[model samples]
Target: MKRLNILVTGGAGYLGSMISTKLIEIGHNVTVIDILEFNKTSLSHLFVKKGFKFIKADVRNKKLLKNLVKKKDIIIPLAALVGAPLCDKHPKKTKEINFDTIRYILSIIKPSQKMIYPNTNSGYGIGKKNNFCDEKSPLNPISLYGKTKVDAEKIILKHKNSVVFRLATVFGYSFRMRTDLLVNFLVNKAVVDGEIKLFEPHFRRNYIHVLDVANAFIFAIKNFSRMKGNIYNVGLSTANLTKLELAKLIKKYVSGTKIRIIKNRKDPDKRDYFVSNKKIEKLGFRPSVSIEDGIKELNYIYSNFNFKKNKNNY
Candidate 1:
């Protein structure tokens, strides 16, 4: 494969940190732009690489973004306010970064340049019972976070030169680890607190490892001709599980963890759906890490490491 010039926004973030490093390792010239909201040292190790370049700036800066867009062969937009709770806290900021920044990029980039975007499968809010959601499924986003991502996806599809991955709830460890994610949170609670409280435990959802998601970007870059103009649901097909089932799995790793199921209580974030990964799988993309492996990794991290000063939650 020939070396290509690629730009990644939010490169110091959890998923971005992994993606930036992988792109550099494969001999691509990568330029990363991030404001470093969480941890400043996430990309500290990549500073010495010849192909890696880091710029500390917000994606909403139109002048800086337009200049960067002109020189890249491929663009991966990973910058956004990720979860529902975080988006709720900053509604105005969410609209500007998640939706508006994307619109601005679409207007400036040439039709020849390729863009790979990551969207959440939570857009399939409250799916019909016993039914699986595919890429063709109707998107009914519940939260501000989901709505902005779904809206952004609609505009990206119209461009016909972009690839969108409707990703499942991502898990596992990265250079910038996130413990607030469902699987990671449960595992950490089990290890540290030895107990958990569940509301609406039977609501089902899908999952995928963070590394698998990073690899999907590389796969799309290599096969852009075949993947562009289409949206694929990226996830592990074996891991469609409910909150209760997930807690039980964590207990297997962390022995004697107590689980308290709270009935008649409501979960504020009511995203519940099972996703079908058949589309991406047919295209020859498979996720390597299993939920069991991810839980074990999180268990080790929480039990041994000192995250006293680390901001693991957003």
Candidate 2:
């Protein structure tokens, strides 16, 4: 593979930290720009690498972003207010970073430069009960987070050089470990509290490992010509289980953990849908880590590390 110059916005984030490291390992010259909203040390190891560079700047800074965008052959925009709750907390910042930043990037990048965007599968809000939502599935984003990503995706697709991956609920430990993610959160609850209260246990969703999500980006980079101008669902084919199923899986790993289902209550996150990875699977990209592996990984981290006292956001 030819060595390429890659720009990763929000490169210190949970997904960005992993993806940027992987890119540099493959001999790509990676320049990461992030405001370090979560943790500054996430990309500290990358600083010593010859081809890796880190710039502390907000993606919303148009002047700096334009200059940075012009130099990169491939751009991965991971900057965003990630979850529903976080987006709801700061709706204005969410719009500026999630949707507006993307719009700005599209306006400046040359047609020859490749852009691989990570969009959440939550946009497939309340998919048909028995059916799997594919790339062509109609997006009905319920939250501001999902709506912005979906809207960004619409414009991104218009650029023929762009490739979008509708990623499933991502799990697994990163340099910037996110305990808030579903599988990670449940596992943390089980390990720390020894109990989990489930609301909307029957609600179904898909999942993928953080490393696999990073690999999918690498896959798109290597096969950009073949995969460009398209949308692919990236996830683990064997792991589109329901909330209760996921909790039970965690219990299997974390022994003595009690699972309680609460009646007459609802989960604020109403994203319920099974996703199909057939589209990306056909392209020969397979996720290596299982949900079981992610659970075990998180269990090890939470059990040993006291994230509560740590200054870096876990």
In order, how many clashes per candidate?
0, 0
lDDT per residue (tens digit) for residues 113-203 in model 1:
9999999888675656655799988778888998999999999998889999999999988888788888888887888889977889988
- TM-score against native, each model: 0.97, 0.96
Model 1 weakest lDDT span, ten residues long: 123-132
The residue-by-residue lDDT of candidate 2 on 9-60, one tens digit each, is 9999999999999998999999999999887799998888989989998899
Over the full model, what C-alpha lDDT does candidate 1 score relative to the true structure?
Answer: 0.90
Clash pairs, model 1 backbone = none
Give the clashing pairs for model 2.
none
